[model samples]
Target: MMNYKIFIWMLIVPFVINGQNKISGNHSTQNLTCSTCHSCDIPTKENPCIKVCPRESMIRIDQPVTDAPKIFVINKIRETDIYSPVKFSHLAHAEMSGLAGGCRTCHHYNPPGNVIGCSDCHESSRKRTDISKPDLKGAYHQQCMNCHRAWSGSTDCTVCHELKGKEKSQTSVVSNNKKRIHPEIKTPDKISFAAKTKQGKLVTFYHNEHINLFSLECSDCHSNESCIKCHSTNKTASTKTISEKIKHKKCSSCHNTESNCSSCHSNSEAGGFNHKSVTGFDLSKFHSKLDCARCHTSKSGFKGLNNECKTCHGTWTLENFKHKSTGLVLDETHSELDCENCHKELSYSKPVCEDCHDDKSYPNNLPGKRAK
Candidate 1:
């Protein structure tokens, strides 16, 4: 009986082996073998499977990495030493980008993939992949300011950087609850914002007074968007020098030469002050050859017939009604000279007889004589 049983067990085990092998043979080579059949689709500790998955199913299984850090560099000078560090702000800026969609909106990557580490191209020292490596400071300012400029709103220096001597966090918005602790005190009404011009002229502009009296929309002088709309990035600006960037176009639109003058000259008592409460001057002939400020003096408030001739052609008496014919007085032969000759410096000043009269003597030939 034992011999019969062993023989039967040998035959049965062979049959089981053949059955398992048959099952394995029927499936694709990339899929399960007999021993692995049941565990086929599952990923495991020892043997992971990429085995015969659909594209979408692969994505579901592999799910690409998110929350990767976008990194760059910035160079800041501390105690006369410059540090170029690999600054990574994955958390804070990711929230902003998620709302804006994705990384390509602000950052550019080469040989693209879902990767975010800056080391793909930039070095640990914050150096670029190629010979044209941008320094860390240049990289940051270019990226940040370009995005900032593309966004629709006012762009001023204060928007990103603090004014020369202020803290970055100092300019942040304060909540009402936080304000209640100390309760910011209102500034006293008498406090003024007057300042002296580069030319040593005092200019006083009243902020509260204009708000209280004129009922002026803040946009009246400023653009519809805000104060910087006209003065800053949106407009085409040119200056005598970089320091003089506040071109008068910003102010002249609201208070042209006429209105700026009316601020004071409208109330002054001076003859031929036939100052039209005009919009601006329509310069013609000789007047066109004069400097804008020649008649628009700080003392003159920028208007009036400041045409006392002496205002421009100083001290030479117009043989009373002398220029009435040419409508400009040629008191001395100096007055008879070409308009551009004396005003050649291209700044507004009196057309002096001595400007061209090399032989002319001062206080005799011309009063208030200026050497050419």
Candidate 2:
């Protein structure tokens, strides 16, 4: 049946991809198409025919924890009322999930529109005939137990829920309930890795540059990380047995791993990413904070830019290019003067005044008036 669904989907792939000018709700920018989450060819507004398996649904979006509700009353299963509804601390759980997994920790199978709660998939009643998937009560307790049992080492139901009519136990002292987001992870400036390469043994990964400098979010790199990576006490990492090609899989997303062995690995420890060293363009002054995609502009990968102002901004004859954006607005005299008078180089990295005034050099001479 799955193969039949895929076969039918292939026929309408072109139309849904190009012909249909449709925008999915709350996920327009996501470019959510039929194939993104649906297995059926022509998914309608009434029925999307969403794939049950979350792994099969390729649209996994991890949203900020603050965006989620602070507290959710997991009282969907009211039939079995031996216990009161679980007052789930959503934000607290979200913050705790940060160390292990993001939203996927709970919302494992999110479609394009919104995250599907456990009640959506799991049946509310435990006495249901379908034993394939655990009922809602089973699903809820299982998810809660994974972490609660890990910490407490007991399956005590009171850890998450309180008995009926126990008003005092229903509400626990939660700290700053509204402000429930994961604390910003302190990124390391450099992380040295011992690579099993012939030439370069050490590779330094720049954790800080990727976040603050490159403007990469935590989710961009840590998409499907497991909780065991950090919290597991006895779980041994399986990286030792992995092949050389597989070793570079993590970095292959943005970097060229096959040919650039020496770029990352070396006899000594590798240094952090430097624009001057790699692209011959020093990003220290101006371009340090800009994302790599800003200048690269290519959706495929980051290639070197020409470094000339005209390369991106065409014919900057003084009126177009705003000097004020550079933190120092040019004065009338400096602005009026042709750029060639001061800047003689092909690139604007450094400007020289040798042509205009032999005695006056840049930084010493006031070619342009500093804007107040």
Candidate 3:
């Protein structure tokens, strides 16, 4: 009887090994390498050596808040609870997410196509076998509580959920939430920072000028910021305790913070950025409407550029050039001449008419009527 039992156990071991191999083969059909899910090259069924979710490598789709549903009724989790479903204002949170990390703040593992919900990745039931990640209810509370706690300094259940019996009509709640949107963030025109520097103390930053004139987006600087940065319940949260490097990190991206200290820092509050005063290139005449990127093409921030027409407008000729747009329309005779005939210099400054007529000169003897 003992010999027969040993032979039977040997046969069952091979079948169990084949079943494990078959399970692994099914995973291979999905075109995933061992490293995709496992940390080790050879993972066993008992110890798969599964890697934790790599959020940084995950592909995320960022859509406008207008594309998302305005409201979401969270009812799947609290079916048997005393509270009714929470009417979550999706649009309101998405709009505020612009300052933060966008959709990745909540949807950490979002891939291409439709935005997935927390329940898709996290198991809805608490009795789930995989205990590595949080359950659906835990995920919902974790994501919401972090920001809500900072903003209000409280994580009360009633803050989001409405008690089943004491709640208002569901129709009214859904209708009110649909129209919900984040309040417009007021932008400052300028901010004067008191810096501790030997060169200067006051650093006057033209805030609106960077947005309107420089064409910088909010995310360029505020991408890594948390909800506490803006929505903190404590109004007395001072930035004075922040390190010097942290304070200059944002400006260092565009400006030479290491060497050019006096450019920003000054003994007194400095005026707005002056192109002519700083770079000797007056943009008010021709390049006022142009974007900063139109001229500053280098990835290492704006560098000194040659102030010559040929540097940018290399293709400009008598036939293609529009003189009327320059506020001076040339006459039939002058129009026929090449650009170098009057404007001898590459700078394209005031025209010298002495090359043709000895007595005649620009501003006195008009080539053509000044364009209206």
Q: How many clashing residue pairs appear in each of the predictions shown? A: 1, 2, 0
Question: Each candidate's lDDT (Cα)?
Answer: 0.41, 0.70, 0.81
Give all candidate RMSDs, comma-separated.
27.1, 8.7, 5.0
Model 3 vs truth, CA RMSD: 5.0
Clashes in model 1: which pairs? 261-301
lDDT of 1 by residue, 1-372 (tens): 999999999988877556645533324433444334233543343443423212221121111324453332232422213222324344445434432423443344422224433333333344434335454445555666665565534466555443434433322322321332322224222322222343323333445544443334344544322213222554544212432225344445445643354342322232221223333434554554555455665552334554344556574442433443443334455455455555444333344456557787433654323433
Q: Give stretches of model 1 more than 4 Å off.
A: 1-92, 98-101, 110-114, 118-130, 152-158, 162-165, 168-372
lDDT of 2 by residue, 162-257 (tens): 677773432342443334444565667888877766777888788887777666767666766555455454445523376767668868988888
Segments in model 2 whose C-alpha atoms lie over 4 Å from true places: 1-55, 58-68, 78-84, 95-101, 147-158, 162-168, 173-184, 235-246, 285-294, 318-345, 348-372
Model 3's lDDT to the true fold? 0.81
lDDT of 1: 0.41
* Model 2, global lDDT: 0.70
**Cα TM-score per model:** 0.22, 0.67, 0.83
Of candidates 2 and 1, the better by TM-score? 2
Show pairs that collide, candidate 3.
Answer: none
Candidate with best lDDT: 3
Q: Please give, for residues 141-246, the per-residue lDDT of candidate 3 as tens digits.
A: 8999988898889979998888878888878887776565667789999999887766699999999999998788999989877777777678788343888888
